[model samples]
Target chain A: MCLKPQHYEDILRDQPDIGWFEVHAENYLGAGGAPLHYLETIRERYPLSIHGVGLSIGSADGLDTNHLERVAKLVERFEPESFSEHLAWSTHDNHFYSDLLPVPYNQHTEDLVCNHIDQVQTRLRRPMLLENPANYLELNDTVTSESNFINNVVQRTGCGLLLDVNNVYVSARNCHYNALDYMKSLPLQSVGEIHLAGHAVDDSIPDEALLIDAHDRAVSTAVWKLYDQLIQLTGARPTLIEWDTNIPAWQVLLNEMVKADLLLNQPPARLAHATEN
Target chain B: MPQKTDFHSRFAQALQDPQINTRPLLKPTGTANQRRRFDVYRNNRAVSLIDNLRSAYPAIFRLVGEDFFNAAARNYIDRHPPTGPVMAEYGGEFGDYMAAMPNTDSVPYLADIASLEWQRLQSYHSANSPVLNINELAKIDSAELVNLRLQRHPAFSAIQSRWPIGSIWTICTSDAESATSPAEVDMQRSESVVVTRPGLEVLTNVIPATGYLFLNALVQGKTIGDAAEPALTEDPTFDTGSHLAGLVALGVFSDINFTTE
Candidate 1:
């Protein structure tokens, strides 16, 4: 379950049955106040993972050293079990757009992303997980498949992957690729965590509907199916239910976590079949 | 073929200006329109930033209504997107932006209200510290109290406005369902407010001329005795003892440093 400030009091009061909680690292980067106080207190009880939204790991100009330092200090303070960042860039020319922008899959981008990831890992002194981005439009210069690019990044930087299942489904739909085949091609063995979230479908264009990784509502049935298939391939991993925007009540999020939990406990028939074969 | 660096610059340009098309830079899928596909990035960039401003300035949103706020916010986001990643620290200068915008002149108090809201948010996320209680002030001899140099808490901020922003802020920040309308405000009056988060919740108090003068002096590192002199001159009836006690009880000061000459 992703820890939200709205549910801090409830979690502290009940200490709900869950494995661990993930927080957007940027939200807790401030010097002090209720966010830090509550996070520190809650962190004492449950395991934590620091997820960063602004790392810009794929920027051509390289990483923001100042932001990286702040994030490094936060990682030291909280000592989360894992730290993760996106494969997309959100900042360039000293201006942060606050949206994860896509990067082309080519040799230049592959080198730039790997170098940035290496810098982040060296600074933090811990290998971080790089999650694949949900692309709305493919860049014209792409010379490689998205999966191949991710594979190169993992192999070069020696970092794990935070496989966001919904991103796979959304990118697959938008870019007209097979989600299962894309997932199968990646270095699934290096996947450290799994992300399941909801997306909004934009259908203004005639034939195809573009799926926006909105994270605003409940996880769709299609996304849940993709998650199940991935789990079958990767076995049980530290899965998170991310509902960042239009956050609902505590029970609503709790129900989503419970659903994911039920699936995690079940044995994968595919794994059984593979062993039987 | 555009270089990787060229792609980023052009994509960033497109994200900022909708007029610029990403055309050959983006490959259009079979049925998907490239412009519409690229608009998702544009829309996401603008909407996400606009939503951030809306959350940061809810009172402004309420005063101008969503349509006006969204349009104004779009302009603001285009002009000044955040330089860093911390969303909480993004809108420090939005109040100044609103003040300079020609369309917002009708609501004269809009800028001050935005400042107050920004101050409240900063105080909410500011560093925590142990507040100095009134009992601490009582232990000092009356003579030494005159020489007391108090350091304010990290969460403390003082805002002075020519319009009745204190009253307007109170009305706008109330439960939306039961909020008082902006028509209730007396547009001619000036107001000052002290915002502090001594505990978990932030408190905003409207201060009189005397109180404002006294707090302003202290903010400039003046001694309590020096601070009170101007307040007394501002209003002859200024009761220093009572006002001091009130500020102390509010936990406005975090520590009493050594007296300065």
Candidate 2:
């Protein structure tokens, strides 16, 4: 569930089967502070995952060692169950515009991203999860599909995939791709966790309102359906409800967790598809 | 190929120069009544930056109207993009930026207030290991006191200003209701404020000029005896007795490193 720093202890006091805790790795990157203090305390009890949004992993330039080292230290300190980052870049020329920007699906970009992922894993010395970004634009030509690119990364680096269901649904709707087709194409075996978030509709642009992945509201009627499809496909995996901005009360998140728990227990398809190999 | 930089270039353009981005983004065909498309990223970035500023400087935002604050904040972001990846640590130089801001010239004290805010944030995130015990300091003899190198908590920082920035910060964070006046501020007087985290929470206290000088020296490689020179010059009545006790109480000192004189 999307948790506030203030709510760390109280949430822990009443732990309700949270699969793991996802913290903005930057929050605890400092050498010493209560943020780190509480996170360390919580890490003692709950399984933790570092979800970084600012590493700019997909950038063409060399990977940010400073950022990597900070994340590395956090990994060393927390020793989280699984760590993850986006398939998007957030900065250029030192100006840190901390928002996830999409990358084109092509051989060159894949090669670049794979190298970045390799560096991250090598530094942390653990398998990290790469998430599918919620794309806002789609182009006519590409060397590979989004799922194909992800599969290649998994094949290359042995990194796991954090399939953000809401992101896929958002990207698919914004870019006019089949959400089911995208999920089906993914290497389901590489899937480690799932993220469910809320999105908002933009008002300015006509015929193409921005599908903002703002996690303030409830999982849309559409997203819930998509989640069901994913669960049946990927089976029960670790799930997180990420509400970053406009965080609602605690009960709101619990409700979402309960919803996910209900879906997890449901049986998967009887026939496990044979490997292509 | 140089085209490999396409991801980097396009992502950069999307961030600072979205207009240059000819790259086709996923267009949402179904929903369009109220949803703004590409503008979503821009709005989100702006909102995120502004929200971060609000958290960093609630008092300043409170002082300025939302409209004015936002307008200034947008300009601030354009000029001083965050070099650090962490958004909370983004506006480290915002106070200095605001002071030199051509537009925010009206609120002369705004910069000082921003300085106070910045210090508070530093205290919030600075490293605070266990303090050097009071008994530990007492163990040092006159013979071993020279060349003592002491390190303080990372959560500790001192800011001295002409304006009553500390009082203004105190009043702003608390519920004083009405706006503070400069005449009431005694801006002609100099003030130094130290921000530290004794426990889990951040605490800010106004320090005497003597205390500021003394700590400043100690933070440097000054010997305990050498550091006392600054405080004695600043105040003839400077008491090392209660002063050292206060530092210990605040979890300021970490350890004492000594070298032969």
Candidate 3:
């Protein structure tokens, strides 16, 4: 969710069952203001997850102590139920690209990711879940599959996986991998939270391919199908409705929240109906 | 492979130089249009930094139009990112960066404005202190006044500028005014602003050159007599009683300690 400071009050009032609120950690790093104040207020009412976009966990360069310290400080203040970051490396040399650029899923990248996870968990004094990237390129021919790479990070660092179903669809479309196969390859025991967000189709790519996780619109029917598959494979995990850009009305978000609840508690018969329909 | 420092390692690198090769670091030839994908990231980093600069110095952005501010902010972000993650401290050097900007020579006061805004944030975040009462200060006689070593509130900041800076900063940050005439603002004119968090809110109050000098001396841990000298030199009409009373009423200081030495 874009989770604007202005919208928090009305959202809590109108939609009390929204469960939890997830926010970009960087937005609240300031000393004091409406953003921090509102987040603190909302946090009192609901659980929160500190999701980071700037960590660049898969890069070859060393972790940024300054950024880690900021993250650690926030974790201390909020004492959030969960904290998560992307699998993508967003830096080259020492500069940081703010976007979650996809990482090559090789053994080296895997090891690097695991090490980064260890540092974050150590600094935060808590476990963090690593989310998958929405791939545009196939990434590495020599490296292990995406599932294996994610599993490796989870195994080595004892971190949890924030399996984004929409990402599975986006990557599968981008690289022509089967979404079902991607889910099946992962060690399901490590799965913690589930993510459902919107993805845009890269019009330039062939085979109507290349889905970019823009999180601007409603979750597409195809992504919902993939979500059904994952939920059936691994039942009853906490799901988040992520809409970062082009945020719609609170009702629209509530609709997504409703969808999330449906999938989580939706029984097998209902799951079949939810998936089939 | 180097030890994992933290998540910001790669993000910091990504912001530095775009051409630096990540081929050795990432998985080989995994998909198509790596450049296109990377562009999305490059765009995001640039945008975040630009947005941060605006947030840090809203008044400065308002002085210049949004278009101009966006351009200046972009340039500053590329040249200097937070060497540390605390964004409050990230843009502290932005004042110098703005001053050095060749294009910004048109607006000489922009840097000072940025500095003032940065001070506002510093004042907002600084350690909180309780206000000392006037009754306690009344107990101090002439000898104690001469030897006082006052404690300043953490959220105390002083900014001096050559332009109608305080007025300009106020106009820029507030919605009360519309257009500003660059001609009306004399380049040689000087003004000082003091940002203090007396209570829960941080306030930016316009101060005279006298007060600026006086406060600077106090900041340096000077005796009350020593501080009065420079302030007197700066403004012969420097009204110490009025200013001191006003500051006391505003709760700008805590305990005013007196030492015999």
Residue-wise lDDT of candidate 3 within B68-172, one digit each (tens)?
778877777777654543455667777777678677777788778888889888777666577777777678786767567677767777878787688777767
Residue-wise C-alpha lDDT for candidate 1, range B1-261, written one tens digit per residue = 554448888888888878886786876545547788888888888888888898899888888889988888887887888888889999888878877888777888888899999999999999899888888889989898888888888999988999998888788778866666778778888998899888878899988878889888876788889999998887888998788888867768898876555
Evaluated at residue B60, the lDDT of candidate 1 is 88
Docking class of 2: acceptable
lDDT of 3 by residue, A197-266 (tens): 9887667856555567788899999888788778777777778888876778787787887876776787
Return the lDDT, model 2, position B181: 56
Judged by whole-model lDDT over C-alpha atoms, candidate 2 comes out at: 0.77
Q: Give every prediction's interface RMSD.
A: 1.2, 3.3, 5.1
Task: Tell me how much of the true interface, by contacts, candidate 2 captures.
Answer: 0.65
Worst 10 residues of 2 chain B by lDDT: B26-35
Best by lDDT: 1
Every model's DockQ: 0.77, 0.48, 0.24
Question: 1 or 2, which is superior by lDDT?
Answer: 1
Model 1: residue B228 alpha-carbon error in angstroms: 0.8
Which CAPRI level is candidate 1?
A: medium
By DockQ rank, best first, the candidates go 1, 2, 3
| Cα lDDT for residue A93, candidate 1 | 85
Tens digit of per-residue lDDT, candidate 2, span B67-125: 87788788889888887788667886777776676766666778878887887787888
